[model samples]
Target: MEKFPRERIRNFCIIAHVDHGKTTLSDRLLQMTGTVAENKMKEQILDSMDLERERGITIKAHPVTMIYYFPEEKEHYQLNLIDTPGHVDFSYEVSRSLSACEGALLVIDATQGIQAQTVSNAFLAEKHRLVLIPVINKIDLPTANLTLVKKQLEDSLAIPADEAIATSAKEGIGIDQIFKAIIQKIPPPPSFPDQILRALIFDSVYDPYKGVILYVRMFSGKVKKGDKILLLSSNKTYEVKEVGVFCPKMVPEEALYEGNSGYIIANIKNTAEIKIGDTLTWETGGTTTALPGFQEISPMVFSGIYPLNSSEFEKLKNAIQKLQINDPAITISPESSVALGSGFRCGFLGLLHMEIVQQRLSREYGVDIITTYPSVIYKVSLRSGKTIEVDNPAKLPDPSYIDHIAEPYVKSYLIVPSENIGEVMQLISEKRGSCESTESLGHDKVIMHCYFPLNEILVDFNDKLKSITHGYGSMDYTPDEYRISDLVKLDILVNGEPIEALSCIVHSSKAESRGRSIIHKLKERIPRHLFKIALQAAVGGKILAREDIGAIGKNVTAKCYGGDITRKRKLLEKQKEGKKRMKTFGKVDIPQDAFLEILKTDTKQS
Candidate 1:
């Protein structure tokens, strides 16, 4: 248990786009530094979630401390490297992780060059004032064009091309260069150990035995096992149970000093008691001044998450609350649906984030849930000039009572190969988005500056963009100003009963097409019943799309094949009468999957 001086420590993280080999680069660092033993090593060692590993995308931020011997100086330095997610949905995770570091490694694929998140992450690192070292990864690929990529580094990212380091993370090449760059380029944390305690809680996780394990960055001062610490956000004090550092795993440390990024357990029982961006100080003599916390992220996507079993509502609630502790970026509130029973209206950064939360609930908490159609928070102005925000289409006021609806839009950065720009532009028009400007980068890739309604791209925009570009396209977006649109409420009816859960807000121009797709998808999922079930999508009492689920029919004439025709007619009329009565009283047995099917967005058209 040794404490290192702030001068010999460097805190850094890797930032890049999806599939840019960030995790692989991180793996190389751990291997080169010998932080992880050869026998214990695995691919994407930092990505702990099964989903992350399966999808080959980092879902959560991971931190580890590595001891590197600088042969030139003949001294060991402690490098705290936090691996972050590359997807745009996890941008918030990247931002919070950056707040704890003094530098970052901006990894770009040499084969693919600079993509969407490379720019977004670089912007984030600059905002945190972190020194960025650009690393061009995957140089061993046959398609690797280091020359073109270097030029892109200067043109698109404005970074000097010579500053970029070329390496193939998969082949374990140039590992020492990254370490040398980190030590020679990145500066030590600016901290005052003699001053009163000031640490920022950037992230945390819940443990059944330890309660809450807080991941922290010590800005100044020091903390020990027996020290009493106060969290400024909660205004509560607790005795530190233990202190440790992430050596890929929890390695107990005697004391955490200034510039150290580590963990603290204070026996805090509830996650609500400890805020992610809260500041920590000594319980008695600490200064009241709090470190600048992270910006509160507003969810760009909203959906309802309901458990399959109604009585398990509490179980789902508890599960979501626990998850919220780990990921505070998600917005949660109690919401009930007439068709789906009780559930929570959850808000997420994007569709991927929402999907992750739903999967976690099912896998981690073992809760089978249904997710409603995703929507964006819209600004609705009533005829009386009173404006309100609506996240759910069912909550939207009637068309007669509303004056105009403003939908959220994003300034999107879409980069694609030159040949696919035309198709990409056409796709943009299909989604009700416009290309504000186009800038050609290097020789082949073009960056399209587009403004798209946030809701228009929620479902499968990224997927479609990738398909059209043959997987060379990438997009990153930030919320832009809300604009008034010709919008309407599209509601679905099941056997003459309005299903609130299947309703969504849509642009009036696309309502008919969207409705037709939804009902068709629903028809595929809805099971045959004894009585005919009608599925309709309507707005203002006018049906825009209709699909029928035929009843499970029995051949009334089959049994009377050899009998008289009059007898067959009597049997057929009786059967028809029974069907009419059943249709009046019988309910459609819609599967949980059908709800998702009805809300399944047709991304191609959207």
Candidate 2:
């Protein structure tokens, strides 16, 4: 493949808030460049995952190279656009994409103006020292307030309003302006061709025939076929088998050069060895000074994942390993439960990430799995002066052996209309959070910076915020320090045996109410057996709540015609004794629907 000059190659990405039409604008760019034929075009062309297309969201960063013919300049240029996800849950994806590019197109929904992620992504781009071009999209909508959006751009983001490009990506309007702006405003990729090979592994996928195929953005040098490359993170070496660029599809190139965005295929059978944020340098005489901004990601939420059928345990494990190749953000370790059998206790960035993994397992791998209740990591200070992190409630140490338990906190940034500030404040207070400060954004929108427990906002907090603000509010959060709290483990018991999968850590004040809600839902779902069943919720040795299910009695005296009263009494006494024996040995089968209901209690009732 003939290489384009580094000065004419621009590597940039699109960053925006959720539902802001970033993907649509990407489609427009691809169309305008004639990268995809008009007949072959489709919505969200880069969203290769069926799950992403069905959810109408991008879960991965997609990089593609397009050739633009400049009529005025009378030359062709390479435009490598990395399309990224806008959801805050996938901010890691956005940040990693930003690292591989020199410029970002900050797309904003004109109807909604500046959102939480809009500001959040803008800050992230600035942190990377990249040039940002603010693009106001959805201009053709009747509800789009271009004036208000431009004002927010100036007030919230401090970007000049006149510099913003107004576009309707859906109608293909103003695409030429955006196209021209890329060449005129955004700078080209920086090249260091004389340096040793240093390609950032922004993403990777598992290909059965080719082993692990890596998607990398070249930083300092070049790598060709058969060149020995080492993974700086793992200190392992492999020979490069192939090199190519994404023309929306893999087109074999002579070599991936400096400042180029492309893939490197190698004999990497073990996908785990390739870390996403790691740098790839020449195996020999490699520089120790690795690329900046690459750090290990720690998951914020943890949950137990078990195959619904125990026979699929190995299959589930294999599926998880393959999924991990795509989503390295998730952490997993072997775990077992008496009730659910062998499984993995996996950690995730958030609830949405957890849900996506579960869905992908079912969709992609055909694995039927059951996911237990989700949890956040807790800091436990032992009485012996040793500190341990507990991400699962079942693994929590006995209360007698603890000095104090501290829960993780988050500094949340919320943006909402001024009129909804009172209700939003009340909602935060309900979750045991305190407001730190508030600043006015533009004219009517207010940004509230507050602090709350990580567990408090783990589930339905954002959903509630959207509901309270009539779908106009947005939120972004960062992990804060852990603080001491009166937290306790809430255990659910059937008869006398505790169910580990149903247990969770809860604040002391909410323990009793939470226990009652679980028992109430259990009673409605549980069926009467031959023996009396007792549903109980306990904290330590104290029973906080209970529900009873009476046994299914048989009519013992119906067949005895004109039987004496003592005879009936004797029969009833015998039945009571049998029930007593059965109660001692009976096992209650908790249906899958019941577990789902208990999770609903924890997620919604909280």
C-alpha lDDT of candidate 1 relative to the true structure: 0.89
> What's the residue-level lDDT of 250 in candidate 1?
95
The lDDT of each candidate is: 0.89, 0.89
Q: What lDDT tens digits, residue by residue, belong to model 2 across residues 147-262?
A: 99998888878999999999999999888888788888888877564678888999888888998989999887778999999998898999999999987988998899878899
Tell me the TM-score of each prediction against the true structure.
Answer: 0.92, 0.96
Q: Which ten residues in a row are the worst by lDDT in model 2?
A: 597-606
Please write out the lDDT profile of model 1 over residues 58-173, one tens digit for every residue.
Answer: 98888899999999999999999989999988888898899999999999998888888898889889989999999999989999999999999899788999999999999988
Q: Where does model 2 exceed 4 Å of error?
A: 600-603
Q: Runs in model 1 with CA error above 4 Å?
A: 309-318, 523-534, 547-584, 591-593, 600-606
